[model samples]
Target: MQVLFITGQNQYGVVSHFLDGMREDLESVGVRTDSLSVESEQHIHRDLPQLLPLQEYDQLISFNGMGLHLEQAELSVPQYLKQRPVWVFCVDHPMHILKRIIGLNVILLCVDEEHVSFAQLCGFNARLFPHAIGKQQLANTSMMPLEDKSNEVVFPVSYMDSGSHRQALTPYWSQIGHWVEQSRSVTRFMQFIGVLPIGNRPASLTLNEQILRLCVTVDSYLRAKQREACLHFFAQQNVNLTVIGRNSHCYQSIAPTHQYLNAMDFTDLQQKIAAARYVVHNSPGFERGLHERVIYPLALGTLVLTFETPYVNQTFPQVCLDAKQSSGQISDKEYQQRRKQAHQQIEQQHCWHHQLRKLFTSPTTSPDSNGRTR
Candidate 1:
C-alpha cells in the first residue's frame, strides 16, 4: 500500500519521533510509506511532502491533522473528507467533541482499548494502536551503560521563548525549592540529567522558499513557551542538574539552585541516569500533562516522579509511578527497588524499537485476529 503520513515537523517533542518511525517500519516491511509535514525537508525526516495536489496521490494519512492549512495547502476539512482515501488519527487525550460535531468517518490510531471504546461511543471509527517507539535511533545512540546506583535525579526542559522578556516559572520554583530543602527522600535523586540543548542551526531556505517556509503557528509557539515554564519551575531544587545537549534559553538564562553540569557524550548520559537517586520530570499543567522526560527516565531504569495527569495513565501506566500519589517518601532501598522494577518493564515492553515494529504493522489478515478488517 502507498501511504502518505503527514505531521508537523518541529522537533518540539515525541510526535516527530513516532511518526518518522512509523514510515521507516512500513518501508522495511515492504509497504510504500511517505512521511511529510511542514518540516519535511529537515535531516530528521526520511520522507518528504510536495506542492502537488494530494488528490492525485494513492493514499493520504494525516498525523492528527498535519496537512490541513488555511491557504498554503488550500485543503479544508470538508475537501479533505470528501476525497478521503484512508484517514487515520493518532491522538491520546480524552474524547474530543469534534468527532461528534464534525461527523468524521476516519479511523483513529488510538492509544488503548479504552480509548477505542470511548471513541466509538462518541460516534467515530477508532482502533487501538498501542504506544510504540522506532528502532533507527537505537543504532544511532551511544547507548550509555548503567552507573553505580547513587542518589541523583534527571530534570529535562522542553523548548523556551527567546523573544519574551519575563521569566515564566516563578510560582512553581518556590515549591521546588521547598521540596529540595525538606525532602531527604530523594537523597540519591539529588543528581539530575537536564535537557538536551538545541544546537539551533536554522535550516537554509531560498528567497521564494523563505517566503514559502512555514513558521511555527502562534498557538504552537505558545505551547512551547508554556513547556519552558514547566522546566524553569524545577530550577531551584536541591539536585545537581546535568544538561544533556545544548538546552533552550530559559534554562541557560537562569542561575540554577542546584549545580549545573554537561555531558561529555551520549554514553555518559546512561551513566548519569543509572547513578541518580530518582528522576524528577517537568510536566506543564495543561489540558493533558504530557512530558517525555518521564517516559525515557523509566525506560532507562530510573525511578520517575511526574505531575499527575491523564496522559501518563493513557501512555505509560506500566513503567511510571504516579508522582501525585508519591510523597517523595521512599527510602534509598525502596528507590532502588523501583529502579529495578522499571528496567524490567523496559526490557519486557517499553524498548523503543520493539514498539515501533508493533505500531507500523497494519492490522493483519490473520484469522486469529477474528477476520476483522479496517
Candidate 2:
C-alpha cells in the first residue's frame, strides 16, 4: 500500500513530529508513505496536486480537513486523482460547507463524535478517529529518574487575544434574545428544555450557523476561563509552576507565583517532559474531547496532573488529580505506577498503528472494495 498525507502546519510544530512516527510505523509494515504540509488554506486549493503527484499513490489521507480546503478539493482533486480514496481526518467540528462536500469517494474521520453524527445526519460516511500518541515519542525520550526530575509542574498555555474577542463579543451578548437573560437558575432550567441563548452570534450567521458558532464560542470561553482559574488556584498555593508558551499574559492573573517559559520544539519539549516529575494539563473545559496533551505526557511515562473531567475520569481514573491538591500529594511510587499504566494503555489502544489497523480492517465499505479507508 502507498499513502499520501496532507496535514496543517499546527501551532508549535507538534503535528510534524507526530507524522514522523506515522511514516516510520507504516514503512515498518511494508507500506510506503509520503506527506505534504499545508501552510495556508490557499496552498491547499492551488498548490496541493502539483506538489503531491497522486499518480503513484493508492490513497490520500488528510489530517485536519479545516485546513485542507475540502470544498475546493472536492471540486479540483477528483479531476486529477479520480477514484483514488480520499480520507479526511477531521480534528474539529465541521462547521462549514465541507460537511456538504463529503461524497462516496470522500470519507470523514473525526476526533469528535458530534462531528461524526453531523456528517452521518448529512448522509455521508464518517467514523470516530480520536487523537493518539506517536510511538516515536517513547523512542526519543530519555526518562529521568523520579528523584532527579524537576519538582516544578509545567503547563503549555494557549495564546488568546482576549481584548479583541471581548470587543467583538460584547454587543452580540447584549443583543441575545431577552428570554435568554433570565436568572442563572432560570437559564439553566431553560437549557433543559432546549432554550439556550445564542451568545454573541455574528450578524452574517443563519440560525443554524449562529447556533454552531455559539456552541464553539461557549466552549472556547469556558476553556479559557477554566485554564485561568486552574492557574490561579495553583499559584495561590505557592506551588512551583511554570507556564510555557508564546504569551504569558493570557494567564497573567497568576503571574506573581508562576514562572513563564517560551514554547520549545516538540523534540526538545519531549526531553523536558521526560525529565519533569509532573506536567499540568488544564481540561479543555466541560465534556469536550481529549487533547494531545494527555497522551503526549503518558507516551513518555511522565506523570500528568490535569483537571478532572468526565473523559479523563473515565479514561485515566488512576492518574486523575483534584485541582485543589498540591503536586506532592501523590507519592513517587504511586506516580510511577500511574505513569506505567498510562504508557501501556496508550501504546496498546491509542497509538497511530492501532488506529490505522482499524481503519484498514473494518468490514464496513472501503474505497474500491479494497477494504482500506486510506
Candidate 3:
C-alpha cells in the first residue's frame, strides 16, 4: 500500500519528529509512504492536493487537522481524496476538529475519547485512537541506565498566552476568565463540568450548559493557570529541574530554582527525558487529553509525577499520584518501579506501530448515522 502523510511546522519542530517516526513505521511494515509539511492554512489549501496524484496512493494520513478548511472552502484535495480513505491524527480541541472536517469523507483518528464523541455528535466519522510513542525511540531494545541520566528532572511546557494574546481574548471574556483563574473552587467546578462524558449527554443544552461546553472547547485560560500552578509548586521544592519550551520568560520569573532551557526539536527532548531521573508533568486544569509530554517520557522509561485525573488514574493507575506532589516527594525505589511499569505499558498498548496496525485492520471502522463508529 502507498500512503501520503501530512504534518505542520511548529516552533519547536516536534511535529517533524512525529512525522519522521510515522513514515519510518509505515515503511517498516512494507508500505510506500511520502510526507508533506505545511506552515500555514494557505500551504495546505494550495499545495497539498498538488503534492502528489491521488491515484498514486491508497491512503492519506494527516497529522493534526491543522491548516484545513474542508467545511467552508470548495477544496480540490478533499474532493479528490474522497475516492480513497483519509485518516486524521488530531491532538487539538474537539471543537476545532469538528469545525475543520465535519462534512468531509474522512476517517477521524482522535487522541482523546472526548474528541471522538464530540465529532460523532456533529455527524462526522470519528474514532478514539490515542497518540503513541514514535518508532525511533521505541526501537531501542534496551533501557538506559539511571546513573547515566544527566538531569534530575525535566519538563516541557508552553505558556498558554502572551500579553498580546490576552489582550485579544480579554475583550470577549475578561470577567469570566478572571473568575475561573482566581477561584480554585470555580476552576475545579468548571473542570468537572468540562470532563463530562460526551456520547450520552443531552442533545439540547440550556444557555448555561452551552457556556460550560464552551469552557471545554476553549480552555486556554485554565491551561495557563495550571502550568503556572505547576511551576510555582516545582519552584517551592529543592529538586534540580530543567524546563524546555517557548514562553520560558513567563515561567522563569516564578520558578527561580528551576533551570530553564530553550525550545528544541523532539529528538533532543526525548534524549533529555531518557536521561532525566524523573519526568515531571503537572496536570493542566481542565484539559482531558493525554499530551505527548506524558506519553513520550513513559515510552523512554522515565518516571512521570503529575496530578491525579480520571483518564490518567484509570488508564495508567500505576503511574498516578495521590496528591499534588513535586519530584522531591518521590523515592528512588518508587521511581524505579514506576519507570519499569511505564515502559511495559507503552510496549504493550501505546506504541505507534500497534495503533497503525489497528487503524488498517480493525473492523470497528464503520460510522453510524449519528457519526459514531462502534
Tens digit of lDDT per residue, candidate 3, span 1-374? 78777667665667766676677777888988876556666766665555556557666677776534333244345654456546778766555455456566667887766667666655557777776765655767355776676656787876565344445455556545654545332234343344333245544432244564555434555566666667776666555568788766567676777788877776777778888766776655323557677788777777676654457656777774533543345666776788788778877887777778776655685433333455
TM-score of 2: 0.77
lDDT of each: 0.46, 0.62, 0.63
Alpha-carbon RMSD of each model: 13.3, 5.8, 5.0
Q: Where does the lowest 10-residue lDDT sum fall in candidate 1?
A: 188-197
Tens digits of per-residue lDDT for model 2 on 162-276?
A: 3454454465666543422332222232242243323443223223656655544544544555666667777767776778777764565545678877777776777777777
Which of the two candidates, 1 or 2, achieves a greater TM-score against the reference? 2
| Candidate 1 per-residue lDDT over residues 38-122, each given as its tens digit | 5544521343334335554445666664554423334343465555534555553323323322344355556555445444544
Query: Which has the higher TM-score value, candidate number 1 or candidate number 3?
Result: 3
Model 1 residue-pair collision total: 19
Clashing pairs in 3: none
Indicate the TM-score of model 3: 0.77
